[model samples]
Target: MTDLHTHILPFTDDGATDFDDALDMAEMAAENGTEIIAATPHFNIPGIQSRSVSEIKDTFEQMKNKIEKNKIDISFVLGMEIFASPTVGEKLDCGELITLNGTRYPLIEFGFSEKKDFIFSVMDDLISRSYTPILAHPERYDCFISDLQSLYELYQMGVVIQINKGSILGRFGRRVQRTADAILCHRLAAVAASDAHSPITRTPDLSEFVRVLDMNYGDGCSPLLLEENPKRILRNEDVFWESPIPFDYQR
Candidate 1:
């Protein structure tokens, strides 16, 4: 399996505290059947300025060395959970943004306020520059939870959607869980990720995600979200997806 969203880079943001924490997360990820992970640290959030892409590359290398030293087999890729700001475009233009697996697919986040008007505009700005924006954990967004149709609209506009694994397992609560189920039912989510931060609270494990998906959506559905789609994204290939029919079919 492949994990496309992770906060495993040490000291880059609010993720791992040091190198040891990174190693622990990597080990946990490997045990959970993950072979590749995109180390997406927090970047450009309110009052937080994380490491630049070049610095992230350095951190990734250091983490890779640590993994090798420990004999843990897991591949690391570069990415960032870009907290959307008014200066997002400027940041992307100035090399502050990190794309997942170094492709056009950039993972982005938003504030909790009613920035509905600005959502698509920001996505459009990125799109105009040849970037395909993937809204990170849209199910957790308050605005999206209140207005579920907006998510469908965004998906229709060619924006990829990633649903958090914990949300599906009810780790986030009812609103997020409801939105997550709706997303799965509609085939709105292209990938499922463990937006993991630590070994305990936000551990980098995909096992529960796989279990819940299989139990709820069927055993075959888990691979499409947890494995195949993430693999395709890393290869910079188009995710082969079929919209679920209203008649309760996988299309």
Candidate 2:
């Protein structure tokens, strides 16, 4: 399995504290059947100054070296979970941020309480600039939880949906868990990721979610979310999704 989202680069963001912690997270991921991970640190929050692209690359290189030294058999690539803003297109244009595995797919997130229009506007701008924005963990946002139809609209607009594994496991909350399940049940989610922050709280482990998906959704669910779709994104190829059932909001 390839984890497309993670905060594993040390000193880059609120992820790993140091080199050792990053190595520990990688080891955990390798043990749990994850073969590749994108070291996607948070970028461009309101009060937080994110590390520059050069800085992130430097940190990723250091982590790569340590992983090799420790014999952890997982590959790391560079990415950023960019916070959506008006200037995001400009940033991408100027090479201030990066996409997943240097593909045209860039993972982006909206504020938890951001309204649909604001989110859509940012996504539209990104799309206009020829970047396919992958919405990160939409189940955690109140706007989508309040009105899931908005999420479907985004999906129809060609934006990829990625749900966090922790959300499915109820680590975030019951609301997020329900939303994640709804998204999965409807076949709307294009990928699932660890979204792991550290070695402890949000560790890099996809095994439990895979088991749950296989047991509940079917044997085919895990491979589609965990492997096929994510690999397509990494290769900048189009992702073929299952036909989505409508989200039963009354439930």
What RMSD does each model have against the real structure? 3.2, 1.3
Q: How far off is residue 140 in model 2, in Å?
A: 0.5
Q: Check candidate 1 and list the clashing pairs.
A: none
Model 2 ranges with Cα > 4 A deviation: 248-251
Candidate 1: tens digits of C-alpha lDDT, residues 1-251: 88888889997887899998888899999998999988888888777656667888988888888899999998888888988876787777777776887787889988756467788888888888888788889888877887777777787777888899889989989988988898888778888899999877778888878888889887767788878988888888887665743323221
lDDT of 2 by residue, 113-192 (tens): 99889999989998899988999999999989888878888888889999998999999899999999889888899899
Which parts of model 1 have CA positions greater than 4 angstroms off?
244-251
> lDDT at 43 for candidate 1?
86
> Which TM-score value belongs to model 1?
0.93
Alpha carbon deviation, residue 113, candidate 2 (Å):
0.3
lDDT against true structure, model 1: 0.83
